[model samples]
Target chain A: MAGVDMDMQILIVDDYKTMLRIIRNLLKQLGFNNVDEATDGAQALQKLRDKPYQLVISDWNMEPMSGLQLLKEVRTDTKLKDLPFVMITAESKSENVVAAKQAGVTNYIVKPFNAATLKNKLQAVLGAF
Target chain B: MTDQAETNGHEQRLEALVSRYKDIDPDDLVNIVEGIINTAQGDLSSVNLKVYGEIEALSRYIHSARQEIASLRPDEITDEHIPAAGEELEAIVGATEQATNSIMESVEAIEKEAETLPPEVAQRLTDSVTQVYEACGFQDITGQRITKVIHCLTHIEEKVNALLETFGEPGERSARERKANETSGAADAELMNGPQSSEDAISQDDIDALLASFD
Candidate 1:
């Protein structure tokens, strides 16, 4: 879903650098130019504070810190609060989903999702669809 | 706990059946049907009472999901009936994660209990764990390697269980297979990421020489 002229900064957080690159390229293809990358939740937090990002696309599982943890941290922090956050995961676990929802994730996308599904989930999170 | 050897053997038979399904008889269909019926009768909802129980669990999940959504203040919250899907997902993912955790726990328990046994037994347990780990697709991020490993491991696990039943020890082949896997895994990682140091890259013969570790 594209509005006439509004740019949004999207932060892609994943432990796998390859996954981050893939998501970054995918978002760029979708016409979102302002994009950033982080390897884990902690790094994501640092980046979030260093600059403002309109959206966050994160993986559910990672060492040191997790996507859910990042979501909670983002929601709890006053400045970064209300940022549109999405959880992308291979884990379809109910508790994981519940946990993500509880942490204020704007939406959840299961792994192996296509570009269409990614767009749909983003729209759902942004309330555009 | 159920006998791992028995389970492994059962899985191997399942694998053989899946791979050679074209050869199975029309009569075997009756047994397969019976198995499905039995599982559904025991594990699936056979009556309203069981269905109600499942719905109750689902309702709780839905309620929580709704509360979370309301707080996010989206542009418009479409009633996607997330709880219904959430309920189904909870059951499926919860069961899988529980099963995996249970198996890992059993392996850990066996390892701990076997500590007092001979060194050979301990080695076997370690190898068994390694086999299961690889089979479960721990190393490969692509998920294909894990799928193939799981298929093979399921067969091997069944064989290992049977060997344990007969010999009072895990199967030797499982450990040997695990060792082979480890060697190949290291080689695979090297190939994908390249060697840790340039000095290790002697020649094509050098790569062949390194493979001796697996052998």
Candidate 2:
């Protein structure tokens, strides 16, 4: 079943427009053609309701709905619960990590991360095909 | 395709580094890249959380209002209720706008900082930062290269704040506010494309080589 699954559909949510474009392009570069974006958690939720996304790559902090809140929302909703969520942030503090884990973040990546690191984390969370 | 081209380009850059700094350790370059990336990512995360908090507050308010609205009986539908609902919706939207602005501000700060780093490093950092930002949902930063600039500003803010503290900074509070204001305008613009693309995700071999050469 996993083998038959095509490129993963990823939802990249951030409040910055440039960041969204960068993620979309990055995913495309990675051979993942199915990518969508939401500027914040609310919009991201709307998109999630509108479609099926295999993975959600989100920023930890945002307006109206932070990544943690979104993660919690996704987890609490029966339909969206258990969705794979990777929280990307700039904070590397242990507390932040613990908080995210507690909130059910599948993985966390600190900002300014290189492509290599991002790929490794993704592999860890999404698993290698 | 674009990411592929970007990766190749990055490879060429790594090769250039190997040839250009024979006396330097490749790891040094890698370290530098890592430092920049880590710091930038940290800044991005803070921005995300700050905006997220604001949104959550607003969302909660909306939820409360929604509950109240639901509790009202059919006969309770009054002209007064209509205005209140509109006001609540306006507040929610306002909160969203505020959160968006905060995120944008952080992006701008990151971009500004990216501009200060070494060219290749700056570009890579810029790309990665932007990619994360966009994957999160911003539509405006699509083709922009402002992540570097924003990162640069954050660095400046840190330096400035540190310096002030070292000298027993008196205007510490205002200094932070001033720094925040400095990047507000940068956030006003829309986004550009994510980093060069997944095709650009550097391979371990290439990364090792670059690090080795830089070491």
Candidate 3:
């Protein structure tokens, strides 16, 4: 596979600070250094509007707003509609996957994923990493 | 001679009267009455004793149950203890995040410094750094599980508070307390399920299969 751009600005969103850090570290291992963090989808949306992020990796469950809700908002917005969105969730229920698919998520990754799984999902979404 | 004969006849009638009355013994009649009275008194006393014992046992049981309920006050379970535990968990998560960030930063620095080293040695160093990064991933899953635990504790606290309100005191119930009581039964089933086990949760492959069906 060809090399992935290490400078692609990515946003990692989760309610847990530890989750955000772990994702940030994982992205760093995959050679993506320009990563921003958000505690939830609401904050992630704010950051998304304020800055240009090539990719969004977000947890599914959160207070006030969820990753799926954020995805819907992104899909509805004319400017950010085509942005790549990857959902990170602990649930792999069929209904949840279908909902995410209908919401136009680029890809889905389950929790407790290793660097290899992350790489594969990134490759699938962003192409040849 | 005629007077003597009449006296003898009267005497014979008197003897007959005496013989008929001989079958009725006053001593025996008195003994039978006394025995019946004694048996009735014994039975009555035994019944009364048993009833008193049962009443005493029931009273003791009720007293014990009341004490148990009193011990289950909101202060014991719902007070600062649960919230404090949640705060402690939050602090641990925060510390873990900080430590993980430090490790990542150090790894990055090491990776940068490994540029001038032998190719194999640099690759090994990079691999080791990657291992550290992967190890830090535990914090995320652990944090997620702990969040669930905190949520459970919060639910328990709500229930304890509601119990205290309903059974605690008269006229001390607030609107919030009433609302808590009303909504206590309405907890989300998903949230209440806590952390799912491997058997309970579907795998990524299952998700992929479902997504594939969408196509």
Candidate 4:
């Protein structure tokens, strides 16, 4: 896999603590050691602004600011606009995909994905991994 | 003899009139009877009209209350949300099971290979594998929590449906209709399907095709 360096900084955002833990474990399995977490989109956006991350994986449903809203914010910000963003949601609707695409998401993954799916999605966004 | 008989008859007639005069005050009795009848008629009509009006108002209030309760079908909390959450939980369980199995298989494979390795290295690998096994126990706890959540949601749905049946308006949407009308949001009407059944949701291939079309 030639996609992302294992040492690259990654930000994962989800409202559910279990989900966060699950994703963190999956990333660990994938050998991605440098990872941070935010409980909601607002906190995620704050983290994005404060730090430099190679990737952002966010859940769609969250309080205060949803993943879509956060995507829009990331796309609009001058410094963060180029950051590769992936939306991880249980929502499988075509409209959601289109909206995320329109908002400039790097990729999309439905929830309950395994290490392989995450790896493939990361590869698609970053390079051949 | 004829004069005595005439006197006896007149005296009997006078006695009969005087007997009728017992329980005196005929004028007052006439007034009492008239008053009772008049009051009964007047009061009954007035009271009956007032009661009828009150009943009409109560009916209207009930109708309004029913309409309000029917409208309380929340936008956020849908019957779909519960099932979607369940599906997610199921997926998690399946994934965890698969991972656990894979880890066990790997450990067994490693055990066969470990015979060539030194004692300390073999022990370390075994301990690491054991930790992986321990971590997989999270699935059991998560599954229990998800089951509890599903039960609570099911209970809520039953109560809501019952309330709707008892108080909802006739033309209000059925569960089917409400589901059909459910939109994800204005921004992503097409993409708002949370979790779909096998039939309704498109596959990853379909998503790829859709994305390809946009290009």
Q: lDDT tens string, model 2, B1-215?
A: 57789889987998798899788777787789878878764455556879988999988987776555446532122224333544555465455545665775676577778879899998887777655554444333221223334444445545544544444433233212323234322321111112333453443344334323432
The two-chain DockQ for each candidate, comma-separated, is 0.01, 0.05, 0.30, 0.16
In model 1, the runs with Cα more than 4 Å from the true position are A1-6, A127-129, B1-215
The C-alpha lDDT values of all candidates are: 0.59, 0.61, 0.74, 0.69
All models, RMSD in angstroms: 31.2, 34.2, 13.5, 14.5
- Taking chain B only, the TM-score of every model is 0.26, 0.27, 0.54, 0.48
- Alpha-carbon DockQ of candidate 2: 0.05
Output DockQ, candidate 3.
0.30
After aligning candidate 2 to the native by TM-score, how far in Å is the CA of B85 from where it should be?
37
Model 4 lDDT per residue over B37-149, tens place: 78764455556979978999999998998767757754324456655765777787677656665665675567557657898997687556545544554553454445445
Candidate 4: where is the Cα deviation over 4 Å?
A: A1-3, B1-193
Number of colliding residue pairs in each model? 4, 88, 0, 4
Best by lDDT: 3
Question: Sorted on DockQ, highest at the top, how do the candidates line up?
Answer: 3, 4, 2, 1
Candidate 2 docking: what grade? incorrect
Q: Return the clash pairs for model 4, or none.
A: A93-B191, A95-B190, A95-B191, A96-B191
Q: What is the per-residue lDDT of model 3 for residues A67-101, given as tens digits with 9 covering 90 to 100?
A: 87788889998889999999887755656677789
lDDT string, candidate 1, A1-129, tens digits: 544223777889987554565465456545677888999888999999999888899886654566766788899999999998987765544444555566676776755455566766676566563
Q: What TM-score does model 2 achieve against the real structure?
A: 0.40
